[model samples]
Target chain A: MDLATVTARLLKLATKVSDEVGSIISNPELDARMDRVPANLGPYGVDPFGFDPEYLKKCMGMVSWIYHNYFRCQVFGVANVPEGRCLLVGNHSGQLPFDAAMVSTAVFLEREPPRFVRSMIERFVPDTPFISTFMARCGQILGTPENCRRVLSNGDAILVFPEGVGGLNKTWRDRYRLQEFGQGFMRLAIETASPIVPVAVIGAEEQAPTFINAKFIGKLFGVPAFPITPTNPLLPVVGLLPYPTRYRIYFGKPLQFTGDANDEDEVILKKVDEVKATMQAMIDDGLAAREHVFW
Target chain B: MRILITGIAGRLGRRVANRLRRNHEVIGIDRRPCPALPTDIVHHRVDIRRRPAEDVFRHAKIDAVIHLGIIHNFRIPAEQLHARNVMGTETLLKYVSKYNVKKLVLLSSGDVYGASAENSQFIDEDVPLMASQRFPEIRALVAVDRMVQSFFWRHHDIETVILRPTFIVGPNVRNAPSKYFRLRVIPTLMGFDPMVQLLHEDDLLRMLDASLKPGLRGVFNLAGTAPVPLSRILKILGKPTIPVPAPIARALLERAWKYRLTSFPAPELDHIRYNTVLDTSRAKEVLGIEPERSLYEILEPFRAEDQADYTD
Candidate 1:
């Protein structure tokens, strides 16, 4: 079998095994870390998964394969990601979640011992058995505020796209301009007292120029939104795969929120805007440096 | 005396500075620092989107303002355009009103009329403005005009005047026609002999000068006396005039836009293709301003300079 087929099959088998054994391997100490935490603090509880170095390596291997064969992405400022609980806030690009994958690779490769991202999974992913099992084993949880707080409090680095679906839905016409961000991540960061590191990813938007999002079709397919691309509809099978695009991942210095966690909503909103502005500048600088959509 | 000019380094700002500097000190603010202007004119670099107008104006002992700063391109997204033009204007107006500025001379556009083939004839100041229906850079001018007018009329202290000029042109023109000139491409002349009306930079300055004088209020069209054929202007610029069908031209333009090869075509081009024209009777009668240079006269000297420079 070719490398891709072998890798895909291995990933499937590994995920199945990990999911079946994950509950048994759960550490009691990690669960007890949340014993004294307020139940009404948020809608979720701390569900910490131990970070296995080998699993992280395997994940990085997958990332390397995808980057070489598909994206050929280059990442920078990977050193800025702290080893402990931190918020990775990045400007969302492309309709697909390629930016997330690139960042995940960067963190894994650049971290001293290599680390895995405590990411938020979409609710729909869990419906598919293989995808859910894989994501769960990988330690990516649902994107609720409660989950974010739990992850951060457990000393795990969490990545959140503050702009949420709006950022992903933006078209080529509105490239680099940030859509309005949700304030939940900011609130979580403030409450957890985690440092927010702004990341900007360029060239993802050009990989598959998602110009339209047909809601009706997306609903029927049980996906978030059906991304309508210029090539995809016309080319079918090959079109679904993102065009190989060079990528630049920039990491801005971490911003600390010194204010009280229970600060007024207006104050938190201002802080959120400040972080958004910093991310926007990074995006603008990234775009200015590159000549083509891919590069 | 302190005066705030939003686009202080712009053509009209320069003219207004020259004309008014003798009496009142003009404080100019723009996105870039203006080191070229005279030392006496205090300049501030600011982005209208984020910077608070109160913070900028509170420092100055400002008396009045000539709010000229705006994104003229209609191809930009509506939010961006609104943020820069509509919101920027509103912020400045609100701040100036709060601080009790003496007067405001708002530079509006003749495109506010929502020009079309039906309104090709001499459109007056009272002509109803059609709502901007185009995507991304829709017409928010009428709303802007109403907002400015209401602020002045309803508010207690501030005085305001609005000058709507048609295709203001001069050496410093950085927009549409100049951009086309820079690209060395003739903009598609959609099979219609549409009359083009333009106000020379000097003439626009003259209108601003009139508005600055006491007792000027309400909207006025500031356009040249006569309109000329767009085809004739294209020929003057040395661009090979190709009469491609409008559909093909649009398709090519769209492709160019996708690749970021060229600036998106202005919504006004749609009106231009359909032979939309503007009336300048108000500018003539009320402001006592007449366009000094015709399109041919303006281009002739530039064309000669260009030929000499290239040959040398």
Candidate 2:
């Protein structure tokens, strides 16, 4: 056989082995997800938000190893994320924001249509070198209302953690209590006429359970807040890794809002409260039902 | 129509001058040394800075002036480059006004829209010129465009059409974008894969020809048919990539560029630093001209050349 043929054969076999490994180590349900990732989708065809599909798949592969193996992520009510454009309003926590990844992966890997939710990122994300492109290429965008509106108007599912960083870096004791949610998501949902699907990600709060909040140290390092997690501040590098806690992601039904995106602040806050309340209830249910953190 | 084509030494200028010579009386002038003309064309060897350059306009009753003599090079200083491009246009504009030339087609680059973090996905021609602020080397285009834009409005008699086209790539193309494609190991900013659009040289030439048609006026963004990420282009070319951090990459590129080892200078690196795709709907609707080939087809020459190299 010619080199091209041989190379193609080798690649096919390699992808097969990888798919098998990905399926074997993770949930059998993920077998299709592993198989669906194309060999090549060019560069920008990977994501409309400028996320590279190949790069995203590679990241998902690594995350799969963690999702299916490390944390053994279990997705619930994933089908509740209705087809077409909708806002995925979820709780953001776990110090490093693994909830966003899990919630997004649940939609990407589990849903029949396999919607790659464009998670709205912070302004600093696109500014950071290398990561900015990866964030964008992986279907993530800055959490601007205009950007969110554009994504939703394009008939694409958008992922947003209404709590912003407040959902993340909360104290160990205050875990699972959703932070003050940002009202921007509600405005976006109303503006774009997109339905809001409340997602409650359990176990993200426990993954990097912090002992203390070191805001001074975080400022010293040019970061927002330095949480003293069990592994962090002590192990440094190893500390970044999340604790192997079982993850359960729940996707709630779509909630429609009829109002102007430029509605009064108090008016928007009421809708924001509704979404936050739904997420809070799901969190309580998941917290009460879970048998153990590690199992 | 007696047409005065500047930058006749340039391959595109020479080809255009030759093509225009078929029907119209052509006056081709340039400072650079050029080979023999095809036929039926008067060649003038003069620098725009000197008085002799305007002698062609004085000598021939020029009806239309195609300003293609913009200095786009890395070797020249920024001031000299600006002086050449801006002053060249000034000299032409003065004569075109003085000579009562009815039509003036000024060639500009789409880079004036600039590759910045905040630019719209597809920048329209109406977007403010931010390219001069981004890079010093790109100021020549910004200044020349501004000059033409003002001249277009200021002079009511002369019908001026400014064409802002993306980087042109075609068979045997040798500018920055083409050179960037030919690099053995293309260095990308470690994390960035900005989108790039390529206008085929033939398509660009055709657009220039179309601009010469009666009643074409105002600024227009001539978009490429297809836009692709920089990484994909390199991947298709089978080039090994070394993703250096932006600062280090900039330093290395500058040195390599200084020594003339690489075609891509530091300033042109901004093109790949951010996505800068121009919106050509205005060109389509107004100019009524569409590129025959997409950016994808424009890279076919490179692919063919690379494949031949592999076989050899």
True contacts kept of each: 0.00, 0.32
Best by DockQ: 2
The RMSD of every model to the true structure, in order and in angstroms, is 25.4, 7.5
User: What is candidate 2's lDDT per residue for B1-312, written digit by digit as tens?
Assistant: 889888988978987887788788888888987778875787788887688876777777888999899878857888788788888888888888987899999888888877777765567777899987768677887888999999999998888999998887876567878777766677788778776777888888778888888887888888655566777777667667888888887898789988987667786777777777776778888877777885456666666354543221
Count clashing pairs, candidate 2.
Answer: 6
DockQ of each: 0.00, 0.25
Put down candidate 2 lDDT per residue, A1-295, tens digits, no spaces: 7999999999999999888676545544454564564323433364434656545656676666777778889999899998778988888888887878888777877888677677877766654677777776776776766567666776788888877777788889888998888787888888778898988888888889888889999898777888898788899868878888899998888999988889899999988888888889999999999999888
How does model 2 score on DockQ? 0.25
Rate residue B202 of model 2 by lDDT.
83
Clashes by residue pair, model 1:
B78-B136
For model 1, the superposed segments whose C-alpha errors exceed 4 Å read A1-295, B10-15, B47-52, B59-61, B73-77, B140-142, B181-187, B235-239, B266-268, B301-312
